[model samples]
Target: MPLALYMLGLAVFAQGTSEFMLSGLVPDIAADLQVSLPVAGTLTSVFALGMVVGAPLTAVVGLRWCRRRALLSFLAAFVLAHVVGAITTSFGVLLATRAVGALANAGFLAVGLATAAGMVEANAKGRATSVLLGGVTLACVAGVPAGALLGQLLGWRSAFWAVALVSVPAFHAILRWVPATTSAATGRGAGPSGAGASGASGASGARAGDFRARRELRALRRPRLLVLLALGALVNGATFCTFTYLAPLVTGPAGLAEAWVPVVLALFGIGSFAGVTIAGRLSDARPMRLLVPGGLALLVGWLLFPAVVDHAIAVFALVLVQGALSFAVGSTLIARVLYEAVEAPSLGGAFATAAFNVGAAVGPSLGGAAIGAGLGHRAPLSVSALLVAAAFGTAGLALAVRRVRARRGEPAGRTLTS
Candidate 1:
């Protein structure tokens, strides 16, 4: 992978902690700000909501700026939000900062995806994406738990302060490594050039910009791309249903002690890290090789999860396998979205980001609804199975349609480039 990718990944590690760290800080935040725990928990949801809105909005707005400028501006805003959040006494201000920080984080992720892909060869896009997205898993594995520890030892405010401070090196790495020609106006595989490389001028440039914007917007309407986005969402939602209520499920039905929760969580993260690492190397070469079997196995795994939910050993084995399979399939779907959106590279990143955020919101809602209905821990597992089945139907439909298109002698992977 390119140095730029590592920088972007590092940047994500810095910002991504803010997303999950709040799960551990809710009690502290609620007590300190004198808000209810439910209200404090809403901060995390607010961030997801902001990302869903911000991804595409920021992509369109950032199209004219060079990558460094756009990424740095977003990063600076994110750090500043943390600074304010750390010092603020009001719950309302903390909520607002979470939203602002999420918006910035969304922009950074969207840009980072596009940049990572553009920095590599066509055949290496999968690896590039994996390298960049690997930071997210690492954040889950190390950053979140570490933040929880920080909040436990000092205060919740310390976690916010730590996130901002950690970004300082990422800031420097990006400044030194990212190229100047990395903007929407520039095509893929450009080397570092003069700062003015993306500087367009006059009526012709304006017309071209308008045309590009229209193309990006139109990319969203493609049938195949839309299906892939939906597939991404369903698969992600399935995983979240399992992930969101993991601790309760462990203790409630699996009969695990409270101490075993973190062990199980860490195992899942480690499995996910392995999945992303291996899948990235191979997804670009033969996506279906991983996707078809991986998807099917995941579908089967979820179907079997409920039966095994009560057995501690079974749950452990199931969680480990599901984590690996989920991320394998999920990463492939992510890469596929970018592959199909060849016409709108920048917009493709935003689309992928928004799709996953949509899943993040949907999965939690479904799981929450199941629990509210008195479905117990097993309810989430059942919903997860249903979600996986929906994902299979989604992929099968996409494949069937593409096969039909192929029979008609149309090209593949274009989706909407025409």
Candidate 2:
């Protein structure tokens, strides 16, 4: 509920828009650049690759710097990347800009989450994390659609320009509103003179930071934890395969009008918002229950997608459920990763995020290839179904591991939910 959270949310919104708007603007970009659609599509893949490579790398590098400064610097880089992308005529240059933008994005998201957690009371950490991630939902529900409209009415370049415009406000807001506390300043070792005026405040701040750092480190060292992270990536990749081509899939086989594609995408975004909100609460309460059901829902949704594509109403309903189920697992998995790797949660969190980007990079390329091979628009959905099944298997594995560890009277890592 802090004003700082709102400011952070704005930055998150801008980042999410910049990351996702490419899906809506792919055609416009391809036409303007005079490149093949698939080639233009590589831009999204490149961005994901950047995130995969950048997440932990950025987190480690930023470890020595103040969290607020790291976040601000990354935001600036993100804005610059979009500005460069807006002006570039060469496809290669544009691709590089996107990569740079994604790298900055990785740093921003990881640092931003850590900073938000630092700002709030212990009981409010979940709420804080949700507020930060809410930016992603807002980007889907609001930012991507607006970007698509801008691309359609003005030019694709205008979409990037719009993204750039948001950066200035985010940059200033972060500077003005985000507090000046460094990881070191907030940690143990402040003298009695400084502690006396706010004794409990200083003690609590240091304890929270220490606990966070230790827990994050411990979570990263577990093998089962790594497996869970991989499962999340695979599940997401499966869904992304189908989702990346949604605009074409709906219009081509479903016989929907082109103008309605954005509206449909908006519906998916709304579903995402609902999913994230629900997932956060469920994961906080009963993560394993949420994980199993969510994965199964994804599988069911994908299996039904191909059959329902011919019916406009059915297809819309399916897409909404698919989006909701696919994204609903995110918060749960994030909490899972943090819980499992409690000693060094930041690295685990970063790795989990990197896994997500890996899935994003793989999904569309594989899906596009299937579509190119005369598999039809439905091919991607089939592939997604297979991936979701794999995800379900992984969840089962995580649960089994947890049970086995519990019975052995050993440290069973952290529980999935607190």
TM-scores of all models?
Answer: 0.93, 0.85
Candidate 2's displacement at residue 407, Å, is: 5.3
lDDT winner: 1
lDDT of 2 by residue, 75-133 (tens): 88999999999999999999999999988989888777666655666444556666777
The C-alpha stretches of model 1 lying farther than 4 A from their native spots are 189-197, 201-210, 402-418
Per-residue CA lDDT of model 1 for 228-293, tens digit only, reads 889889988988888889999998988989999888887788777778888898888888888888
RMSD of each: 2.7, 5.0
Clash number for each model? 0, 15
For each candidate, the alpha-carbon lDDT, in order, equals 0.83, 0.76
Top TM-score prediction, candidate number: 1
